[model samples]
Target: MLQGMRLTADKEHIAVVLNRPKYAGNIGSAARCAKNMGVERLMVVSDRDYPQEEIRQMSTHLAADVVDSIVYCRDLGEALSGFHYVVGTTARLGLARGPVMSPRDMAEQVVELSRKNDVALLFGPEDTGLTNEDLRYCQSVVSIPTSERFRSLNLSHAVMILCYEISMAEIGVPERFTPKMASSRETEGMYGHIGALLQEIGFLNPENPEYWMMHIRRLFSRMRLSAREVRIIRGICRQLSWYLHHRG
Candidate 1:
């Protein structure tokens, strides 16, 4: 980890923000993308629930640490606070929104601005996308150039594209060796507890426990759950179970 940091000499800094994403799988995939691209910080702003099992599994082992490191915010204002430059991603251009640049152009701008001050890139949710109000907070806007008819992209794919661009820009020099993957010990127990909880809640369904376990294994294998994060999630499940069991 230290070596990876040293390799960059800290040339570029990036913060990826997910604004009120509607799906858990997107969040998980985004985490994996962020990790793959060497993005260090991830902020999630939403009132909706996260798809922990789906995301963890989708990210595979590569992005597990990022899932563990996620920070959740209730509002976009809180998510963008303390950052000097903010960039928002959108597919549609509004009369009020600023000029839309390609993702590469956005990355270039980020590199330039980052040389002067800190920067954050924002991504809106799945269904409604970023509202006009959401664009108010950004200094600029980036639009991934897709077909005019189909400009929309999955939130995780967008995150991956931007994070990769930024990471490549920051790590200008080639790395001699690939970075290490998170250790199995990091998320193993959490998966076990979650599996048990799912079984308890009937979220895991199969004719045979073995078949169900295999399905669970394939689904959660992507999460790369950390010890602390697993503990926290398991605690949530435990509390919910207690409430349900005792509820009148």
Candidate 2:
């Protein structure tokens, strides 16, 4: 007799997010992996219309029910909105990027985070991993360890590895010392406010604001500011804007 699968209540707090996925089949496969690992939510950030027939066929019965619950957004920021913590997956690293942790390390953190907050695991498109712009919204990036000969892994395969590790890991609830962090939407707004202030102060040249803004994003992402912390930063930006307008 085939054994029945057991489900965990805690899995409902975690979500898998696919950023600008090019293939419907991969989305389906990712959904299947999420369901198998007990994660109940899947969010897809893509502007392209995905073929329903192809996705359903690929998902089989394993995740057929989950297909209906999948949330679709046109951009990464929208898809990530409201999540308390966001973990992005990347295959490569650079000096400009935020700290990168191994999948195992990330799994430990994510398991604990899921206990009290909505946590997201982000996967980028198949052809290219998350761009610098796309990664700005991610608080941390998780890199899967692979042989130096070849670093690329298929989108679904990467999702399976992360979900599998998360499912098997044993985590205990610890005393909650960490305050609630800012949501992706709140942090994005802070960046926008600060960017505008920088432009006003002529710190960011209008002709080439992106160059400096990219560096600013990396710096603030590393700070992992909490909601109140972001509010304070925005307050300073507002004061600077006011000062520039009223200077004698």
Off by over 4 Å in 2: 1-9, 205-208
Give the alpha carbon lDDT tens digit for every residue of 1-248 in model 2. Answer: 12343322257878999998889999999998888888869999988999988888877887988888899999778788899788888888876666789888887877666666678999999999888777777777888999899987989899999888888765544544445677889988998999999888789989978788877876786675789999999999999899999999
Residue 2, model 2, lDDT: 25
TM-score of 2: 0.87
Per-candidate Cα RMSD to the true structure, in Å, reads: 17.7, 5.3
lDDT winner among the candidates?
Answer: 2
Clashing residue pairs, backbone N/CA/C < 3 A, model 1: 24-51, 56-222, 56-223, 57-222, 57-223, 187-225
Where is model 1 more than 4 Å wrong at Cα? 1-12, 170-248
| Candidate 2 lDDT (Cα, 0 to 1) | 0.83
lDDT of 1 by residue, 1-248 (tens): 44445222122456788898887878888877877776767888987777688878887877888788888888777667656567788888755554677877667656544544556789987977788667655666788877777776888888888876765554333344322222233334445666677778787764544445544543443343334555687688788778878999
TM-scores across all candidates? 0.61, 0.87
